[model samples]
Target: MSTTRTHPVAGRATEVPPRSRTSPPSRRRSSRTRDRLAAAAFLTPLLAYLALFYAFPLFRNLDLSVRGYTVRNFVQGGAPFIGFDNYVKVFTSQTFVPALTHTAVFTLVSIAFQFAVGLALAVFFHSSFRLSATLRALFLVPWLLPLIVSASTWSWMLNSDSGVVNSLLRAVGVDPVNWLTDPNMALVSVLVANIWIGIPFNLVILYSGLQNIPKDLYEAAALDGATAWQTFWRVTFPLLRPVSAIVILLGLVYTLKVFDIIWIMTRGGPAGSSTTLATWTYQLGFGSLLPNFGPAAAVGNILIVLALLAGLAYIRLQRRQEA
Candidate 1:
């Protein structure tokens, strides 16, 4: 005899249909297709932007770098294909070595001092105190102002003759020092200005990172009889590494491309003492009557490489921390 099975519904037995093995896979495939379409729709704008603004410009610049692009090319709408001749010219140029060295020094010194000052301020503000918020807001003024304005203000302050810095030094019985005129001092002056502008950015980021850290960790450190400095080094600093790495990488990229402060203060002057690769590119492209667009593009590509390496480093660090 054959047996029959039924499912109960509303206190009555009803015949039920057998399950189909094919249904679930078909449903899942449709759901996945819908999800993929949704994702692609959301990402389309951003992808388009990157392709239009970033990727296209980068490739166009690369093409220009390999060709004899110049002001004449701008007029005639045609450029000769030179195939890395611009790169050769840039490497062989007298300004290349000094500009490269200045770029390195400026980036390193600005990042180091900015991080140190910013970290100190972040730690100080991390503790509850009166007027702390007000003070921190005040600190942001330098960073908040437009770069041109900040650079101009610094130029006035650091003026060799009648500037406030010189006035103060004179009042203290020291002879007025040439901050912008001396080749030895121009780069240092630019560094000082850049550091000042950069500190608030670092402080804001580091302070936010400090806030995210668990209070329980500090309590645990205290229970372990760790001194404040020991607790900071062992507990806080280690936890802060990821944020610090990000901050440093961002700072490095910003510093590498710094132009406004140096340009306003000295125009990379005093015998090209403060000329970074960025400014050198500017000089090649616009400073002279004959614009060397090819070499300028080559220099720009060099900066892009450095930035890309820094970005890669940041990605690697993040992955390692996640692992």
Candidate 2:
């Protein structure tokens, strides 16, 4: 396209090229296409990772649970599909009740003590004092250490003979109680180790939560003559509810699937006393010469279901709080 104009100095008509109307829209379309390409490029790796690591494993486990997979069958690739027999077998097994009870006790007790001790430590560290930073760092040693090392150390410390704990007991003129060997105390010993390891996590999280609280709230509480206990219950705790909820939820999930600590410490110990679902799954799958892969997968699925339920409950609670 062209246009005509009168040249001011020359007093003659001039011609100019017209702008294309389609260019801007075309550029915009190209920009959108590039954006879409970049987005897909970023998303492809994440999608592949999820498919490979999470989705496929979940599908495989579900398949294994429904099929009767012996060693021979697993390799041969023709495991007989047995429907829900594996789940039924797991439900009817003699160890089922004991394992459930132990799991419940271990998880509940660990979460309770860990949260309590961690909250106390968090509050204590919240007050500015000498060496507080050092002390808090020291507290994180357990959390920072490898789980295997922590569990191994606990095992050594809690050994029935020639261990530091028993030597201390003898010094105090008390009987050397069997910490790990005794069936009754095996779970307790593991719980103690787990609690110690978990406290630092709670402390870090709760301390961060405390840092988010407004100082004015505490000042107001003091101005109103509220005692520390009253102020904590009324203000600090209420303010900390969200952090506490997440900490508890995460703790629940972590504790439920705790395998390495328990396995290393007790090997689900004396007379199968400390066996939780996590250890039981391993035991069923690989502990014996004749592995029951189907039953193991079934147990794993049960744990998945429990974790899913807890997540759902947490989501529901969060929604209610938001509402």
Candidate 3:
């Protein structure tokens, strides 16, 4: 496939080979195929992890909720399908209202106090004093401690009789308060411990957010003679909105599922006075000799729905802000 052509200027014959029209398109197609294969290779592990850990467990939980599972049937694998009867039982139970109320109160109060204290500490440390870093590290002890250790420590510290808290109160000429034994105070006791454990996390996050804010804004506010409170409200809080949103959202999810701390401290005790949906779920599932697996699954599903709704609400709020 050669052709003779005349060179325009030299008036000489030259052999010009013909070009293949299909070469570039075939190379492009091959490159695209390789790129797709590489992308698939990169995504395989993550996909596999989600499928194995998340998707399968969620599906299994859903299946458990729909079936009338008992100890005998749970192992033998012949539980009868019971539609939404478990959910109905959970809804009609006397414990449901109290558990829901406790969960709401515990989650909200804990978040509020945690955020307030953490933000105050973050602002304090942002000023860069000589001992700021050391003190900040000290504050992280609560957050870094193992949950079991933290719960046990709080339990001992809030003991009805010989606790340090009661001793201090007595020294101050105040009556010794029964922190754990009193049903009215049990939730408060756990809430205080939870708040303490959560504060450092919020401080760390908010401090990072504060660091990202432009220093010039603070300088400008100072030059304009704005008070500390004014500067925080105007210059700091607005800039910190995104971090705050994420912190609150994550805290909500974590608090909703909190069982170990409450369980370890009080076993949701004092006749189920401090029981939350999380603890109630355990009580229904495994805390008794005769376990109600389906009802437990339903309670867990309700928690999942609440968390999902909160996530959707956050997304909607973010969209509105962005718009």
For model 2, what is the alpha-carbon lDDT of residue 119? 96
C-alpha lDDT of candidate 2 relative to the true structure: 0.96
lDDT of all predictions: 0.93, 0.96, 0.94
**Can you write out model 2's per-residue Cα lDDT over 1-323, one digit (the tens) per residue?**
68899999999999888886778889999999999999999999999999999999999999999999999999989999999999999999999999999999999999999999999999999999999999999999999999999999998999889789999999999999899889999999999999999999999999999999999999999999999999989998999999999999999999999999999988998899999999999999999999999999999999999999999999999999999
Query: What is the lDDT, from 0 to 100, of the residue 233 in candidate 1?
Result: 94
Tell me the RMSD of model 2 versus the true structure: 1.9
Give all TM-scores, in the order shown: 0.91, 0.95, 0.93
lDDT string, candidate 3, 1-323, tens digits:
78999999999999987897678889999999999999999999999999999999999899999999999999999999999999999999999999999999999999999999999999999998798999999999999999999999999999879899999999999998888878999999999999999999999999999999999999999999999999999999999999999999999999999999999989998888899999999999998999999999999999999999999999998999899
Clash tally, candidates in order: 0, 0, 0
Best by TM-score: 2
- Among these predicted structures, which one has the highest lDDT? 2
Could you arrange the candidates by lDDT from highest to lowest?
2, 3, 1
Query: In terms of TM-score, which candidate is stronger, 2 or 3?
Result: 2
The window of 10 residues in a row where model 2 has the poorest summed lDDT is 16-25
